[model samples]
Target: MENTRFNPVQLRRARIARGKTMTVLAKETGISRQMISNYELGKTIPSGNYLVKLISNLNFPKSYFSSGQASNLHGATFFRSQSAATKRARDMQSVRLSFQNDIYSVLSRYVNFPKVDIPEPLDMNVREMTDEIVKSMAMQIRERWGLGTSTPVDDVIRTAEVHGIIVVKTNMTNDKLDAVSEVIGGRPFIMLTDNGESSVRRRFNVAHELGHLVLHAGVESIHDFTTQQLKNTIERQANLFASTFLMPDEAFTESLLSTSLEYYVKMKKYWKTSIQSMVYKTYQLHLINDDQKLYLNKRISWNKWRRVEPLDDMLKVEEPTLFQKVFRMIVDNGIMSEADLLSELKLPFDELECSLGIKLNNKMAVSEPKLRLL
Candidate 1:
């Protein structure tokens, strides 16, 4: 506390990380709410006992407060169901994303992760996009990435990781926010809610955000669009991207022999897509009529497959392993010890775990044979 200067941004960031409002933090620390506001605004810096109260209540290390505010990245955060997500929830996830971004930066200094790879940049004019255009673009990505010929994508998560996207499952407070994507320091990060969703849903979320990164992020300020209708339109396009990307058009139409739920349960085994998505694609492909689509919906509701589909438990849940593998490589190889990481990042174990998605399962006790701090 003596050498480290208090960063007001860090204080606000930590407050949101713990999902604390100003008044709630005031209650926890027994500090006046007005003074906490002043401290965060940088109108006044806390000294003596006030500082100790924040340290005790927040559980962040002294060095964290000293670190300068992170620079805002160029790309805006793209959130699914923006209208449905609460501001507080968005704030918490954004801070968590920034932390994970920083963790990525620190780790990249020791090793290289995949760089952003796309066949080409997408059409800048989002207004001109249609279902056909989106489908064509999805096909282009499938071919460019060598996902395989008319076959089910072996692993969308693995494809993303191999092609230079870092995907992490986030512990989202809001159920509405399925996923978020932002370009932090030129690196794209996609965060999905780790809410025990089915494997197909999780895969769709990742693909949707990848759509944002490819279709919307650099091309425009999509998140800042003023109207909800436009947002929904863009979101629909991304969904098309995901659906087409997951279930290829020609192959899907060929294999969708029946719209029956029992038949789709087997399709789920093959396409690894939810029955709903497959049915929607079938309708879009003109293989099913409106009446047929309605009948399928009724059957889905009757079978209770609307929310949790068949084979959800049976199919393997896809997760990102690039970070986990790299982190172990660094620590196990003595590139950086656990204590050194804790000291360097200046975050408590839980907060670090929140961002990095790794559980070290140890307190910050001073261990023997200390390595040089980074």
Candidate 2:
């Protein structure tokens, strides 16, 4: 029944995190668009009935609007296909990243998450980056991570989590954006799309984002590359990193017994890589001549295997469970109630579920046991 103090930035974050425009939020909450804009701009504050309505609609605790530290994705964010993505889509993902950072901040108080373990920054000039240099960079990373050339990465998401990289799967349905990675608070964070892509493609996407984090650490902004040539070069470097990182030369070359599509299909299960990727890697390694490579491409196009491939359903999709497990520990160990956790996060039930890829059964109170007196 009283007025509550509101932070304009928090209000804006809540709206962006929900992917709602001013008019849409206004209609949903029965508030005027002008008033919402004024509140977000710090010109005024919501009070009494309006404040209650905001709390109910935003699903944020009243305290959240009053006191909280705000963090943003400060470093460069490498979208898979930046040119194809719209500005609104990028902003929505950025808001989602900020929300994830807030969650990480809350969890850090109770649990110690893994420390970030990205490789040292490369000293090569972006303009002079060659395929050979990129391949060597990938090799160095493998050595640093203790991943041998022959060893296949069983689960890229788990590997990243263990190495202190926070991986989140987002519910962004945009086909143009496969994934994006950034550095925040001196840590690496990657967000993958939950677009029902095959596990193999998902793994490659994770690796590709990792490539951006390592290769473009010093670049200011992805858009800073004004020339299409420069942009293509950097993207090519990341692609090379992903290819070499996933399929090392020695082991991958050894497995290439033939240049036929059928051979690659059989090898797909062993490498856990898409047949197309394997075909490309084979050509990159020069195991198959250009003619052979062109023929293979024609075959892939003929069968439409570019979009869907064999063994796509068989390979298990890697997911991040660390955050969900930590949340469960906080509740199950009595560190915090589900209500408190949700309130602290300022996320609605559906958003929380989507962000963490887990369901929330909010009935989390522990029941007291009866005592028997003999």
Candidate 3:
């Protein structure tokens, strides 16, 4: 049954998930911006023709608007793009994150997901962290996870999932956002933008977020109690962690015969990391001087290898199986059908697929969300 009682939080969530700002939604719904705000703020609920406009425009089940207990995340959410992604964009992403969490909450009861196995954040703040410390943490965790320095992480995504971290890819369609990680319902979930890039690129991005999960505790956003320099420090430290974890110090140093672009390009296959990242790693390790680093960068730009690196096309991108298996076990095994989900959870079809990282195939199977234009 449709919920006539409008819950403002859910209204705000629908607006954000639909990627419509209030002004845009106002124009689309043929309603005043202030009125839209009023409805979302719960000062007054949209009713009658106003409600019809909202239902038609926003495109969420009417029941969703009044779904009980729309939980909000207050934890520190780490984004790959700090300065690039706008606040509104991040808010939209967060709303989706909450929706995904709800999906997880419902499905998890039926499926016992793997126990989370990542190490705790280091006992230090961003201010107290150092380059050496960050690298050390990365190495330690590798050994802890039974991955010694030299072994190429053939499937970092699977490694993360096996260890209890939820990884999913969604098409945020924003170049700025490569990945985002937030601890939801006491589980750390990493959302990678479903950009069809190199597996090497995906590996680095996942490692980068893993760095945040391990090294940067008590430091979530740039807006936190951190100066821009501290933010840069954490960001760079994460990069260092990614590099060190993927290309361990001892093994990688031995592998670096030359700082030339050709040498790193060849090494990319062995390391299963990007040539660009490997070049920067060589410089960061001080194995290559400024002039050599400058020369390599020039080579990268000259060949246009910065964006699409050599062999990026050949390397298969890693896929997250945890969520896929969860859904398969649930729906494929007849625990719940798509219609059952809509009837029970009141989820938007497209949003549900994106959140769970699985398509329902037949959107027509679910009942039309009791939302129609009058």
Candidate 4:
């Protein structure tokens, strides 16, 4: 059959993500290396028989061959193809979400945190707006949450995770979006990166994605954060959410009377915000002039402070990931089988094995070695 309709870019992306050179993949699948290059460059498509062999050996499903659907599911950025690896990655994500949701439901019973209200984002150009509105909204959110005193970043992360948020590792290879939040129905679901980013930056990414779930629901807009274009009002709202959540102006202003570097240094300890964030927030609150803002920005840039710092210095709470907890519960309770998950998630058997990093064939199937051999 003809392979002309498939996308070469997708093929290239899938191959690269799996870290397999054309020669390596060709050897594994018994396909010619030259043909692999051709497929990746869009010069030619694989025959039906060859394609099936590729998918089986690659451990991907038939759906991965389609560029449009697979690419869209991945937010159209990093992984371009629907290779076996991609399908497994997506399945792992879904399983993780399933786990997170269950844990969140249980945690909600004990936590009394106020639920964030979803509001329609005001229709204004995000780029044109000043930072004051963002600051004000953040203050409002903090007040609503009653986080009056300073809290550790670990506490904040735990609380968000309990509310169905999952943190992901971000790298140069992710979708061009700084963050993406997806929540089914009205629940707030978000994915963030620890990336050793400053406590303040991490908080901002979390709150920003949360803002999307609450504010941009039911909207059709581009979510890419790389392009230099006028952002939709919704994107602006999310950024505002992130800024305000990380640095509440009232609490910040109330505690400080001076703009000296010493004062900022002292406050940074409690707020756990980066010096740059403190400077930006200070400028946003009109606590400093444009000159100070420029100077501070230059200082930060010169220091190359954008690099993420290790969080080893901070306290780490035992917050199990959503999927892990849920999968454990299901397995422990005999609520489902490995087969059930594979079929529900549309993952090939081996892909499931790779994604979970567990020996499912043995562990998932072998009936609990007769605990009572009475």
Candidate 5:
């Protein structure tokens, strides 16, 4: 077969994802590092023999180098690997992946998968009741963790992982919803942060799903698995979970007696939540009476600004994403490599730019070894 022309930029990015330095790759492929550098920089075209060696060593398919198509797996878009434009999305992907692991670990203990128990339509009222379930589970979970009423936002997640659950984050195609919590064939799983949400929003999405895992586990066997119904149920459950998990009823009431909106807003940093979520929980827990709830909602615009939004709208970052986290864990643990990534994931290089969101250029070239005179 005639060799297809390879994109040098794409080849280099794949190598980095594999965590193999150019020196190590040079020794394995028996190619001079300078030649590899030249190929990567588009300074020279690689011969068929060179391409075969590269394809084999890098574990990329011959097609990846020969054709310019992006990896079809996960529908990732492959831009020119040399461009740094895709970095921001990839950075958020990394954080989302880290938190997803924490979510999966937490849910796995109670059940193998994350799913709701009921088969009925999860209307607003049923969804809203998730707060009650989370409050109850939050108390129990805290006791299991050997804590008092209130738990730090991060630690709450850590404790959940100790129980076993699978948390996954994906870039949902549209403005569908914030998150989804459910079970697949008796196991528990949750997907959070449909595309365009902030890290803080992602965090809340996980917590809301956790609420479903803990409180809605009883109803999983009956769920119909339709999109709208499932979303409504899970969102309500997660909202309840987020509320109770962030602020326990007893402590919230204690704080509510004296704290104002500004105090709660200030306290948001401690809870790792937004001012609006605190208000909803306070009202639900009855810490703030009806009058206070109405006043707070109007004051905070809970109807409009309920969940946490990002502070910085302009900053862009491309770090590892949830998929990359799994990749990193397996690679770091010696369980997988770049070959496995390509074969198993069928991922394309352009998508890698979006999925990993890292920048590469000719500046960080690998140098050839100098021959020493004996």
Candidate 6:
């Protein structure tokens, strides 16, 4: 094969996107670790068989490394449990984001994706973001989206995607990191763990991440919260935002009907929210007394509903379809062949399949000629 000059940055991205250390990549490619490091550092370029070995091991097309586009994350990510996630796991997630950026870049060439529609950050310091302010912001967002207080958001994932928020569902090794959100290249991207979580919980998670994008976008880092109180306040604010966004005051309060946990259970089918979430929302809205809230918590714990709640099977998971639609458009319109699209993506077919939650098959057939009628 002819030698191709590869970009060191793309090489490193492909390696890290696979969550492989330099040593592991070297072992797979039958190359020295130092040589791989040298290639990534731009000290030396891989050529001939060395380049072929790297491409085969990385599963990226030769053009991917030669392409000038760079994968860069612009802002911080708000992890669900920042302290519980290891630094290695976070770094791997960043690499995954970089790969996603690359995929988006390719898709942009063929389709006009919706511009991100998140509201402007509120004019308040992080220290001044109280629960009331957060609730107000959530209500304002609902209004801006034309979602009336009483209407239940049927598909939160689709809602976000329609507003240009890229939602990715992937299997993460760190179970503590339930979901994460970030602003990359001025666009918001959210990643949810594909761990068989209930639809209600996933919708809440998406709303929670949206809270971070809207509320905490100004904060440089969560680590800046030196005190535990500050950290708790930030998280509490996001939680409040999620609750308020999902169940607005006017509708949720009227639907309260009763303070019993069973009442919340029956309401869950309508609201598409978890019973536990409704209980907390009720308490936050002062519909239930402190003792009532405690009783509901005990009931939840005693019945083992904390992990597996009721009606979990009934609510369907909201899968994203924008990317799939764009991919199909490009292929069906003959803009690009499936093989070419896969090559441009620089991702393994299986990996892309898992990321998009769809299958890719080459079964295009031409129609047979019709016989003339006598």
Work out the TM-score per prediction.
0.91, 0.89, 0.93, 0.58, 0.51, 0.87
Cα displacement (angstroms), candidate 5, residue 319, comes to 9.7
Candidates sorted on TM-score, descending: 3, 1, 2, 6, 4, 5
What is residue 244's positional error in candidate 6, in angstroms? 0.7
lDDT (10s digit) by residue, model 3, range 1-374: 34447788888888887778999998887899999999988898777689877877876766677777686675578778766777777776777777767777777878998998877877477777788898898998898889988878879999999899888876466677678888877788888876676799889899999998888767655576444664478788888899899999889999888777787878988899998888888888888899988988998999998788888888888887787778778878888875775556577766666656676757553475454555
Predicted structure 1, TM vs. truth: 0.91
Note the Cα lDDT for every prediction shown.
0.78, 0.79, 0.79, 0.51, 0.50, 0.78
Clash pairs of candidate 3? Answer: none
Per-residue lDDT of candidate 4, residues 137-156 (tens digit):
55555555555534433456
| Reference-based lDDT, residue 139, model 1 | 85
- Give the lDDT of residue 113 in candidate 5: 38
- Could you give candidate 2's per-residue lDDT for residues 316-370 as a string of tens digits? 9888877887888888999988777776665555666767677767552112122
lDDT tens string, model 6, 1-374?
Answer: 12246678888877876678999999998999999999999999886678778877776656667777567776567777666777666776777766666778888899888988878966457777877789889998888888888878888889889899888876455566678788888878888766678889889989998998899877776666754744477777888899889999889888888888778889999999999999988887788899989999999999999988989998897776767777888889999987677766766565567566667673321111222324
The per-residue C-alpha lDDT of model 3 at residue 365 equals: 36
lDDT of 1 at 201: 85
Query: Ten consecutive residues with minimal summed lDDT in candidate 2?
Result: 364-373
> Candidates 4 and 6: which is better by lDDT?
6
Clashes of each: 0, 0, 0, 4, 48, 0
| Every candidate's CA RMSD | 3.9, 6.1, 2.3, 9.5, 13.2, 7.0
What are the runs in model 3 whose C-alpha is more than 4 Å off?
A: 1-4, 225-227, 363-365, 369-374
> Distance (Å) between predicted and true CA of 122, model 3?
2.4
List where candidate 2 sits over 4 angstroms from the true fold: 1-4, 27-30, 51-64, 123-125, 226-231, 362-374
